[model samples]
Target: MRTFCVTGFGKKLKKHNDLLKIESKEDDNDEAKNLLVSPLDFDAVIVSGEHDITTGAIRLLLKNEIDLMILDHFGNPAGYILPCGKSKLIERHETQSRISSSKALCIAKAMCIASMINKISLLRSIQKNTGVDIETHIERIRKMTVQAESCLEINSLQGFECFSTNEYYSALMKIIPAEFNFTGRNRNPPMDPFNSLLGYGYGILYSKIRSAIVKAGLSPYYGVFHASYKNQEALVYDLIEEFRQPIVDRVVLTLIARKQVSSDDFNVTNEGCFFKNNFKKKYAGIILTRLEQEYTYENEKKTFSEIIEAQADILASAILETGKYSPFIYR
Candidate 1:
């Protein structure tokens, strides 16, 4: 979908001008504030700047049908939101396909519980007739898959005992490249630390959303490589992971590399760490521009949203009739 990112580091904005573009219908000076529309407007806004959200801002965001994100100091979203009608907004979103509801639920429940390894197993199970090369991105998937299992183990048996979320996140921090920056600060951005945290969040969210799509009777896992996750929709993660590299992590890098933001843009509060007032708009701009650009993969050029939608279709067909889910494993 269209993801509009609006961040508020130190201040929140009340009005959004994204939807209203000025048009000139009459003579040169007879310009009225008419509206111009883009077929691909932003779908949601990711706000990571403050602890307590402003009600007026929430209302504005909801009216625009935008998704708002609130993250802690380290940039992790706190588990609370202001029910700004986003449920309804996201709910009626035209799903990518038409699959049966019961099949979707079963696939979603299964995917939520299965680890990356378990998923690989499921992929392997479905690989025979699909011709997907499980080995294509095996190295990266292997590392993250192992860690996901470890996280579950740590959460379950240890009762979150051995490591705090911060500690876990801290370890994740180790993966981003040392040059990775958030808004203004040069935070460590290694692959595992960076990708894993993002992957974890995306994995959870995909299951939540895919289940809805599946219930709408769409495919969950007809991916190119991981063709087997058909009923469960786990294959979407296979595609989304490709995006995390260019989307989130790259934006962080662009800001740091360009010296546009620094550590001063963040703040630590009781709720957790969040963006300071200074850098929200700047960070949001990065994501916006990035989304507008064409991304090249597998010798074809496409927008970020288009690529993901293709993956959704792949999943839809897989669930509906044992179709193959195409994985986006770039060289």
Candidate 2:
């Protein structure tokens, strides 16, 4: 299964037998026609708001249990379409009941500690390749991880996370080239090209994790570490912490180090730096490839996408008190 991203205006999607066909109504049709034959060809379809999808296509997608993600003009997630008739009511009820329980705290702390470990591990990997001395930074984050594990309250856990990440990013910026001008982390229109790539990659990752959580019969709104916010997928936010460094951060850093992304790839507006359309597609492709890459986990090789779903399943088991939750740690 794969993911198909649809963009542009006047695009129509239809189901032809077992195949999915896309046709463009624009006059200048350079990249208009597309066909998705087998149901196994794609598991997800990401459609931009500019495109028009037929009802038949939607029905077919739902029948095939293919996840659908809709993005707004600015490349932010607007909505999602998940399959119906699949329910794990007991798992969900347990999740709601355990919100304030000690189990919740354990899961939250585990996620934070896993995140810290992955960040430190990524830094070490970079240092090994580039010969950059990041031992001080790694040791500091290691101490922070220990604090996170001992934290009984969510507030203190978040505090340790913030401090650890601040130090980690500070060292990370020094390792990268100065031309990217990534002083610090900033979102809601990232301040620099590096931050822009980071934000974009994280958004893509959020959508993937959101789908996985829903498929695992958990609520995306209810969370352990991150509190629910209006219009926010809080649980997705919580689960995504452990993955941010190993997935998106690593991809963006590789792109920058290899000089694959240039200043011309971004457009500087009054808001901040944004990736141009072509560059955005290129970046998204890289992220998707990274997510599909196979890695060894628990003595078995699994794609990063599978790891995400497995993590959600583990969380559900933990919520149900049937098993313990362990966050995915990159090796």
Cα error of candidate 2 at position 254, Å = 0.9
For each candidate in turn, give its C-alpha RMSD to the true structure in angstroms.
Answer: 12.1, 2.5
Q: How accurate locally is residue 152 in candidate 1, as Cα lDDT from 0 to 100?
A: 29
Q: Poorest 10 consecutive residues of model 1 by lDDT?
A: 157-166
Model 1 CA lDDT for position 10: 36
Residue-by-residue lDDT tens digits, candidate 2, 196-280? 8888778778888888888777788778888635567778989999999989999988887788987788887787887776677
* Highest-TM-score candidate: 2
**lDDT score, candidate 2:** 0.80
TM-score per candidate, in order?
A: 0.45, 0.90
The superposed Cα distance between candidate 1 and the true structure at residue 38, in angstroms, equals 8.3
Task: Look at candidate 1 and tell me the lDDT of residue 206.
Answer: 44
lDDT of the candidates, in the order given:
0.41, 0.80
